[model samples]
Target: MRNFKAFGHVIIALFIISLSAWCHGQVELDKAPMEKAEKDALFSTIQGFVGNWWNGSDLYPDPCGWTPIEGVSCDLFDGFWYVTVLNIGPIYENSLSCAKNLEFRPHLFELKHLKTLSLFKCFRSQRRHQVTIPNANWENLAGSLRSLEFRSNTGLIGKIPSSFGVLKKLQSLVLLENGLTGEIPPEIGNLKKLNRLVIAENYLSGHIPDIFTALGDLLILDLSRNSLSGSLPLTLGCLTSLLKLDVSNNHLEGNLLKEFAYLKNLTLLDLGNNRFSGGLTLSIQEMHSLEEMVLSNNAIGGDIRILKWENLHNLVSLDLSNMGLNGEIPESIIQLKRLRFLRLSDNNLTGNLSPKLSTLPSLNALYVSGNNLAGELKFSMEFYGKMGTRFGAWNNPNLCCPLGAIATSNVPFGVKPCQQQIKLVESNTNGSDVNKTFYSIASLCHAPNHFWWTFPFIMILFLNSYIIGL
Candidate 1:
């Protein structure tokens, strides 16, 4: 009886083990195959790029040792798996100057599910030489890509591939600080999904594209420091969503367009160092959100009165230097309670310095040099001394000597006498002899050799005056 019971117990244990194995198989089968393949590709790409030393650096969790890589993520919806985002910038290594030799493991393109590709510092190609990014490798990339970032690729040279515009789903494109040369492709305007586009610090040349005006969704646009030339398109006003617009350091020219008032949401507008000319219009005051404006080094001419800065309460830095401005330093600037740096130098401004400038609680740096400003440099100098600030107003020829004390270390005392330390008795005797000679000369002019007559005439005149008084 004991042997039969022991055999039954063994049978039950075997049955339990068999059920557990079947359940594990079901769990494995439940995972989507396509998703798994995509994850594997992502994992391989990271490992190949990061090298063996970074096999498992606690970046992310992966059950199959292939799902998680740093800066890489995948999403699955409705049983369909796709790479929703890939921010593999911080992990890419670029040692070779040639971008082609930068070792971008082509396997990354196999991630057919990729939607966002951000690989900053990936361009390793040297100047003038075209580094061929394998366009074929991206052949299988899913059509869902929405955003792409390739920033800080200083060595990157070559035009953006026309194929880039084919990314219909692309929303935000950032390719800043590259050595890219040539004109910005007009096809870029085809990217209707684009909102924030930045291509600053490149050697790009040519006119601003009117298609950019069609980008109503564009919120932030920076095209500074390029060799781009031509007039700014009036269509720029169409960007109603623009929050920041920076076109500084280009060769662009033309008068300030009134259409600029359309960018109502603009917070920071920098048109500095361009060839833009003409007078600043009252329309500039329409920018309600303008916080920092840098129109320095342009040929902008005008009165500060035309600009309504009441809306610019948040202004922090205002630079209008070398713009041929002529006027008094506006006391209205004192209303900018948040101003930190104010530069309005190299202009024709003339007026007594604003005392309000010294009293501004937040004002730190104020430069108003190379102007017709004159007055007692006393007010300005005393203000500087009180604030412990550096003052510079060196070259106003009309400015007088006391004010010229700014150029001196110390003020000198009274001038020294030509004859030093004559004996008192000798000086008195010399003075008396000089007085006698003076009287002799007076007598000769009145009447030659008539000293006695001169004395009598003097006495007679004194007596006549006394008689009249009596």
Candidate 2:
């Protein structure tokens, strides 16, 4: 009986030990391989922000596991789950907290596996507290980072770090609509692998660096609305792969470079509101892929006919408003079948408005106001009504003609009533008397409705007398 009891106790002990070992193994499998030190650093940095949802608790004990944090993604690296992308913003509800004085924590650089880091309107503050981007340790992650973006942070002030050139793997870098000042670092040319670099709507000044021609793979380069000045470098033409290039609303001066024709892939080129002078060059006609060309509010001069506009078949929008352009508008412009917006306002252009201009199937907005244009508006009533205020042909003194079918109020402003001309014969009359009689005939024709029938009756009477005399 003693031996039986002892054997039963031994069996129970062995079973309990086996069960304990199996449970331990399962627990190990459930836990993440991420180092506890790195996890604590990430959570601590997030805690400093007042509006963040990350609170150190068992509720999210494994950040890389089932309870993953918002705007944070992880991937397995060397048998450990590491944060690979950190998109800190209000991307998801109850995700990130917004706080003033939100300085980037050094602990963020500890995520050695981070490939992309974006902060959208995250550093904004009601108090206008300025935050400078940290330039000290960016080189630490140069090897891992592939993209970095900081958009619409009004309080972000400071020059872009030249150290960013060391990030060889970076493909896209966008720092749009910030308060950043100073010249774009020439070192940015070193980013050979970069595809898109947009730093528009900032206080950046100085001439565009000639070194930019080195970025052969760049597709979109927008440095608009800055204080940049100087002539564009001829080297810009080397960027054959460029699709969109906007350098508008700056102080840039000089003649448009002919080398721009080399950008075969360019779709949009905006150099408006600058000091560019000289005539529209043939270089622009060579851009077969161009869709929108904006040279408005510049000093560009020359007749519209100087351009071989027929070559630009893909053009959709052409804005040459307020340029010192003169001479008659080229009738060939009607060849642009895809044209939708044509703005030639505030120019010195002359000649009668083309009837075909109003008939273009795709044209919706036509602004030729403030020009020296004359003659009658022969557009269809339906087309004129459809254009409405978009047809701005005001401020032209000699432009005449009443709207047909469409109300006069619907017609473009400053249009005068069409004049009537009547030829009079004064046999044996001197020059002065003939002039007086001509003026009298003109005044008679100016009279209300009676003038139309009265003039015809007078003409028939003169014809009958001449026939009888003959």
The worst-scoring run of ten residues by lDDT in candidate 1 lies at: 411-420
In model 1, residue pairs whose N, Cα or C atoms come closer than 3 Å (at least 3 residues apart or on different chains), thus clashing, are: 99-124, 99-125
> How does each model score on lDDT?
0.68, 0.81
Q: How well does model 2 score by local distance difference test?
A: 0.81
lDDT of 2 at 19: 96
Q: 381 in model 2: Cα distance from truth in Å?
A: 1.1
Q: Candidates' TM-scores? A: 0.70, 0.81
The candidate that achieves the highest lDDT relative to the unseen native structure = 2
RMSD of 1: 14.5
Give a tens-digit lDDT track for model 2, residues 87-107. 776768866755775667788
The local lDDT score (0 to 100) that residue 423 gets in candidate 2 is 64
